[model samples]
Target: MKRFFQSIISSNSVALRTRGLLLLSLLLITTTFNASATCVRKDFSDSGGDLYGTSLRLGNINLTSDDLQPVGTVLATSVVNLFPSVGLTNPDTVMFECDLADANNIYQAFATNGDSNVGGFTNFGDNYFQTFFRYTALKLTNVESGVEFTRIWQKVPITHYATVGNKIQIRGRDFSPIRAELIKTDKYDPTPATNSFGCPGPSAIGYTGNYTCPQPNGYVAFSGPGVELEELGHDANLDWTSWGLVRYYALGMNLGPVSTLTNNNTCGVVSTTPLVTFAKISPAELTAGGNRTGSFNVQIKCQDGVESGVQHGQTSIAIQTSMPAYVAAQKINLVNGSGGVSYLLSDGYGTDSSVATGVGIRLEDSKGVTRYFTGWAPCDSTCASSDNSGWYPVLSNADSVGESGGYTTYESTYTAILEAIPGQTPKAGKVDATAYVLVKVQ
Candidate 1:
C-alpha cells in the first residue's frame, strides 16, 4: 500500500513539471533575444564570396619610363562601367559595388586639391604616412566631377549613394573631362596582424595570397567601386605587363550580398591596353613666322580572330581616337608637364597691354577637324565647346597588318601646330614654351 502511494506521488510530480515547462517554452518562443544594449542585424540566407584573399583583376598597366619616376604614379586603371543601365539601372535597386575599405574599412572623400586620401590609413598603419605611403593616394571624386563617396561597407549605416555616379578618379580644379588617374586608396588597416593588413616587408608577402606591394616604392589599390555588377558580360583576361617596383593592385570583394551581387563582375573585369603613341615635341621653340608641327597617333591592333578585352590584361580593344587634352585640358597630366598650367605664360613676362600674343596652337587630324588655342583661362574651361577635332573609331585591324583596308596595326598621324597667335604681333621676348598633346581613346 505504501509503495503504491509513493508511485502515485512521483507520477503527479512528473506531470506537473512537464506542464510547467510547456508553458515556459510558449513564452520564450514569442520573445526576441537582444544583446546587452545593442542590436545585431543579420541575413541568415546571405551566402557570398569570401572577402579574405580575393583578387579581381583590373587589367595591368605597363608603366612608361615617365610612370616609374613619379612618387604617386598610377599603377593601372580601366574604364569602370558602373551602373550602366538605360532603363532600370539607377541606384534604387541593390547592385554589386566594389568595397573601398582596406582591412580597417577606410575610404575616400572629397577635396579641392587633387589629394583625396581623406579617410587616412589606420590600424595596420593607422594614419601612418611612410615615404611612398605619403604620396600614395587613392582618389576617385573631385569638386569638378561633382560626385563623392564617404565611409562604406555593403551594409552602410546610412545611405551614401552618389547622385550621378560615384568615381574614384581624382579631380580638383582640373579634371573637367579627363577620367584618368582614379586611384582607390580607401584606408582600413585596423589590425595588429601584419599578415591581414599592413605594408609588406622586404621579401615578405604583401597580400594574403602573395601579391607583395613592396615598401618605399610600391603601394596597393582596390577595384573601382562604382562599377555596375552584372550576371553576364564580356570576358577577357587582363594582359598588362607590370613594370618597375610598383606591384599590381589586387581586386578584392566584400562579404554577404555585395559579393553575391557582384558574382559575375568579379570574373568579367578585364585590363585591356590600347596603343597610344605621341611624338610629343614639347618645350619646342615657337617662331612668330612659321608653324612647328608634331604628330600623335593611337593605334589599336588586335589578334585577327580574338576580340579585345581586359580581364586577362590583353592590349586588344576597339577604341575611338581623339585629342583628349583639347577636350580635357584642365585634367590632362602629361608625363613631363605641370597640369592645368599649359600654355599659361610663366612669371616675369608682363602682359598688361600686350596684343593677344597668347601662345598659338592648332590640332588637326585625317578626319578634317581643326581647333585652335590661345593662352589660358576664359578658354581652358570652355575650350572643348568648339571642339571639332577628328576622333577615329578605328576597329581592330592588326591581323591584316598589310592587307586591303586592314593592317595588323592601323596607324593615323594627327598634326599639332605651334605657331604665333593668329592676327597678333610676335612678341620680342624668349620663345621657349611647350605645347602638350594629350591623345585619348574610348
Candidate 2:
C-alpha cells in the first residue's frame, strides 16, 4: 500500500510540472504573436523605368494607442545610395505596410535618424537614418480600427536623376484619428488684356491711364476744387492706371438732377466731368503805335454726354488812357493913367469883348505833368474910383495902378505878355491866353 501511494504522488507531481511548463510556453507564444501583429513594414521603388526592383525592409515596431510607433531600428542589412542616380520626387508617397490585422486607427507617421548614438525621441541628428515619406491615418477594413497598409508611388523625369544608385527610407504610424493627404499642382500664365477687367481702355493705347501723366510742360491747366481728372496709362505690371485732375474753383452743375431741389439756393452740386480747351490769347493793351497781348487757359466741367458745342460766358479786362491838355491865345489892351490904368484882352475873337475878365489859368508842366492857378478880383474899399489904390498885378512882372489921382489923365498904354514854361510843351493843340481889368474916372 505504501509503494502504490508513492507512485501516485510522483505521477501527480510530474503532471503538475508538465502543466506549468505548458502554460509558460503558451504565454511566451502569445507575447510574440501580439508583438508581430502590431509591427509595420516599409518599402521603396522608382516609379520611372530608370531604376528597377529596389527593395528594403523595415522591421517590427510596437503599436501605440492610435498609432504604430517605429522600433527606432532599421532592419534592412544593406545601405543603398540613391542620391547619385534618382532624386526624391513625390517624397510624401513612399509606401509603408503594416502587419497588424486591425488597420484603421492609424493617425500619423514620422521619419527619424537610425544611428543608435543619435538616440530616439529627440536625437534627430544627421548620423541617424531618416524616412523619405509618411502617411496619415486612413480607414481600412470595417472590422479593424487602425491602418492596414499604405502604398505610395513616386514618378520622376529621366533628366532629374544623374544615376540609379539612390535609396530612401520610410516609417509609418497607426492611430484611431482620421488622416488627410494633400496633393498640389502649379501653373503660370502670362497674357495681359485677356480678361474684361484686365483690358485697359482705348486711352491706354500708348500706355496712357491713371498711372501715367503727361509731361507738365506740355499742357495748360485750370483745375476745379474737386474736378481734377487723372491721365490714363499702364502700370509696372502692365495694368491700367488713372487719376483725377481737380480744379481750384467751384464749378456749377445747375443743368443736372443734382442741382434741382426744394431750396431756393442756386448753387449746384454734381459729379465732375473734365473738359480741356486750347489756350486763348487776347490784346490786353493797344496804343497809337504800340500793341500788347495776353493769354489765358480755359477748362470746363459739364455733365457727361453733353454736346461738345459752343459755350458762352463773359469776363472783363481793364481799359485806361492818359489825360490830355488844351491851350489858347488872345490880344490885350491897357489904359495908363491919372485914373488908374485899366487893361482888357479879347476873348481870342474881338466879337463880344466883355473884357475877358477874371481869366483862370491851368498849366501842365510836361507830357505827364499838370498844374493850376486861380485869379483874384480888386477890393472896393481900398481902390475907390478916384483913388489909385485898388490895382493889382496881372502877370508875374506887372505893377499895380489905380484911379484918377495917380496921373494927370495920361493915356499911357501897357502891353500884355504870355509865356511858356522852359521845357514844358502842350499836347498838339491845347494852349490859350487872355486878360481883364478894372477902370476908374477922375
TM-score for each candidate, following the candidate numbering: 0.28, 0.12
Most accurate candidate by lDDT: 1
Question: Candidate 2 lDDT (Cα, whole model)?
Answer: 0.19
How much lDDT does each candidate structure score? 0.26, 0.19
- lDDT measured at residue 318 in model 2 versus the true structure, 0 to 100: 9
> Per-residue lDDT tens digits of candidate 1, residues 252-315?
2111111110001111111222322223222333342555565555443322332233222223
Q: What is residue 440's positional error in candidate 2, in angstroms?
A: 99
For candidate 1, which ten residues in a row score worst on lDDT?
A: 260-269
Q: In order, what is each prediction's RMSD in angstroms?
A: 19.3, 52.2
Question: Can you write out model 2's per-residue Cα lDDT over 1-442, one digit (the tens) per residue?
Answer: 0001124334587898987898999999778766554322233333212122111111111111111112332211111112111222333433333323322322222111111111111112221211211111111110112221111111111111111123211221111111111111111112222221211221211221121111010011111112111211111112111111111001011001111101010111111112212222111211122211122111112222222211111111100000011111112212123222222122332333332222212222213222121112111212122222222111111122322322111111222212222222212221133322211110
Where does candidate 2 stray beyond 4 Å? Answer: 1-103, 107-115, 118-442
Off by over 4 Å in 1: 1-180, 183-290, 294-357, 371-408, 423-425, 429-442
lDDT of 1: 0.26
